[model samples]
Target: MLFFLRMRWHWIVVTTCAFLAIAGTYLLTAEPTFVASTQLVIFPQVSGSEAQRAFAEDAFIEGQLEIARSSDVVGGTVAALDLVHDPEFVDQTPSLQDRAKNWLTGFSSGNGANEVQAQTEEERLHDWATAKLLNMTGIRRIGSSTIIEVSAAASTPQKAVDIADTLARQYIQKNIAMKANAARQYSDWLSTFISEQQRGLADTASALASFTSNPRDQFKLAELQSATDARRSLYENTLNQLTETKQRITYSMSDATIVSPATLPLSKARPRSTLIAAFAAAVGLGAGLALAMIRHASDRRLVRPHQIAETGGLPFVTLLATAKRTRNGHPPRFLAVGTGSSTTARPVIPGMAELSATVVGLRRKRRVVIGVVAVEPGGGASTIACELAVLSSVSGAKTLLIDAAAQKSSLSKAIAPQSSSGLADVLDNGELIETAALPLSPTLKFLPLGRVDTVSPAIRLSSRRTQLSFVELKKEFDSVFVDISAFSASPDANAIAPELDGVLVVASHGRTSIDDAMRVIETLRNVGAEILGAIINHAPKSMQP
Candidate 1:
């Protein structure tokens, strides 16, 4: 986790900051909404067998729930509370997006304007409140039971409570009204039916009287009397049904009961600030970590010492920190040895002592010419070469520093800037090493890259004279450090690598990639250059540099 943070802290920081800003803006600008809920227990009004009742109970209760959420019920509640003119419902503030949409669409003069003009102001306001109420209300069944929960949201606690309670009451009243209307309709139809039955019964009775008075046949009289009795019985039954229907219409009841009433809410239900902030933080952190992981996986820069060995397949040497220059704009005095010791302690350059000791160990018991070359430019190969030469000379070894880079000789520009003759003169003009080499101390000699007018350093270094000059230098100096051009920049390092005892590859920390280091190592090995080891320069403080 720490590695990921260090590698991609910028990505993490940017993403986390952006999410936090959005969360803060919402918290500050968004309006709070309060919710209040009421519950109802619906009863099945079906008249049937037990099996039929059980089958219809669920469907009946479900229909009641829909009725509770219906527009008629909501509109009735709106009218009861006069919410169309209530300040909480009528004077609500519009959001920025809503205002912008209104502004953009306000200029239209079309059928839409005519449609708005068709409705009266009161009707329009009532319809708007009904729609708004529907949007704010929620109704759902409680488990598998006959109870249902209805909730409403508003900008204030009291308003929310009023809406919920009023809506529930309105639904109950609507149920009562529907039952009353059905009973009344049935009562009117039954009264008409009874009137027809009564007239038919009177006709039958009159026919029986006529038959008796006229002394008809005995069989006809008996049949007429039986018919009169049957008609009278049916008419009395119809009259009783009409009387029962009139009683039902007078005392119609609702099928639903309020199990709970809405109470005034104490807190806002929406814009839950704490949960929102935490959720935002979690989402932001997750997004940041994801991006960090992706970036870390794609990056190939070598930031650790273990990566050097894994990529270049070379022994890991000491890590070097960036060397600081003095106020005079020259290399630090530590680059060269001091003559006298001071009373106060001086800061030691990181990695120099370890590197010098490593070089000495590699020398074994004979003269060793170690060429320092970087995989890429600006890898501090020249600085390493200079330090090694200075340290070796101070330690009583006959040390010689040579700048053999054909293109942009950093060592020549920094160390032997005053010297006019160097390796170029020795290799191309057959100048003696004694005349070309400049002295920095009693034991250290500096050879700069003199002017090469026409001949290329590669061709010159490949000649027999360059090889003989290097052999003579080896016989003269106990240790020689050469600053060769980067392998990517020129082929001078390859040309001079075979002549040296071994070559030290230098790669910059966090700048050189594994692939680039591997390619450099492979190219040097293919040319038969002895692979000594590798050094990592400009390492961060977390490492031992």
Candidate 2:
């Protein structure tokens, strides 16, 4: 995670920007809504045992909640509030189908004249308003208690409050109406039953009276009196129940009561801008981190010293910081060295002095020849070779800088631009070696590749004549540094690799691939050349050691 965060930080910034854009768009275009709520308490009439009453109260509360959110209550509220004509309740934006239908209606002649068209439109509007009201209304019981909360949302605070209050009132009215209707039905039935009971009592009384007078059978007379008494008791009980039901209907008592009235909301309920922005930012950061990890996993560049050593199967040397080039038209300085006469110092190439020291320490003899090569082009091999030669000279050692690479003559152009003949002239053209080599400092000499367009033929010629020329040059110079082409580009470096004392491979951080570096090592090993530690060039400042 830390590696990805360090390497792929730009991806994080891009993902954050994308998230902010989407969140800003939603916040700007979304509609604001206000919510208002009212609380109601329900009380069931006690009529049975303790357990039965408790169960009945639970069932009653659940049933009331359902009724409160029912279509009947919502529909009544919509009609009472005249919401069919209200713009907030009705969707003013016409759909494509509605627009097409309106266009057709305007062009049609007989359809517009029909009376049913106007009635159908009114019915559609009413249905739409009822659905809208139901969608905005919410009803839920508060925990295990008999209290319920009713809430409604709308564009305006007043509308939200009005809808909540009206819903509660309509539910209470419906409940009362239902109970009163039931009571009225019971009272009517009881009145008819009472009339029949009174008629039966009169008949029983007449029979008893007649039986007593006749005195023909004592059992029949006692049976008639018992029948008359039972009829009278049933009549009295019916009379009492009928009277109570009538009183209840007159009073019209309801179980639901508004404990808290809905109040106007002070703020909007949805589209919390601050909270939404924070949540979006958090999501964006997480997504960015995930993307950075994926990118880091897929990258193939060798950015660390350990990676180069592990991949190339070689020892790791120090990293070299990238040097700044002069903007003005002057030759670039390689390494910083005191002039021994002035306090003002020239800019020294970073890491070159360290590289030269490493090479010196790795040598077993007093005088040694080291060839600097790279796996790929633009790896700063030539620059390091020149700087190492310069550092060796400043240390009072006779150093020879050879630009043997034929592809690019950058070092020759920078150091000995006036010299027209070099190593190639000495090997192929039979030119004098003393006349071809140019002297830069008192102890430093340079040999350019010398006007060679092709590298392979010149390397072959140098290989045949290398024993005589190289032995005499080694006798005069203390340390020899050869700058050659990239190993992958030509076989020139490999041809001369066996002639040098040791070979140093240069690799650029974040650009050189492990496969390329390994290939270069394998090529040098095939020729039985001595391999020194690798150097990382153009490395970041933090990676320098």
Clashing residue pairs found in predicted model 1: none
Ten contiguous residues with the weakest lDDT in model 1: 337-346
**Model 1, runs deviating above 4 Å:** 1-34, 43-59, 74-136, 153-163, 197-252, 257-300, 303-353, 390-396, 403-468, 526-528, 540-545
Q: Best-fitting candidate, measured by TM-score? A: 2
Q: State the local distance difference test value for candidate 2.
A: 0.80
- What are the per-residue Cα lDDT tens digits for candidate 2 across 369-396? 8889987888888888887887787777
lDDT of 1 by residue, 1-545 (tens): 77657767888888888898899999889988999999998888777898898779988988888888788899999999999887656654657986776556555646686456435446867888888889999999999888888899998898899989999999998888888888889888888888888898899999988888887599999998998998888888878887887777788678988998999888899999999888988888889889888878887887777776866667656688876776654445323223343212222347877888889887668899999999888887887888888878878888998887777676776665666677877775664677778777788888888877776554576566553366777888999998888889888877778877899999988898978987888888888888788888887655673
Residue 248 C-alpha lDDT in model 2: 85
TM-score of each: 0.69, 0.76
Q: Residue 438 lDDT in model 1?
A: 73
**Would you list the clashing residue pairs of candidate 2?**
335-348, 336-348
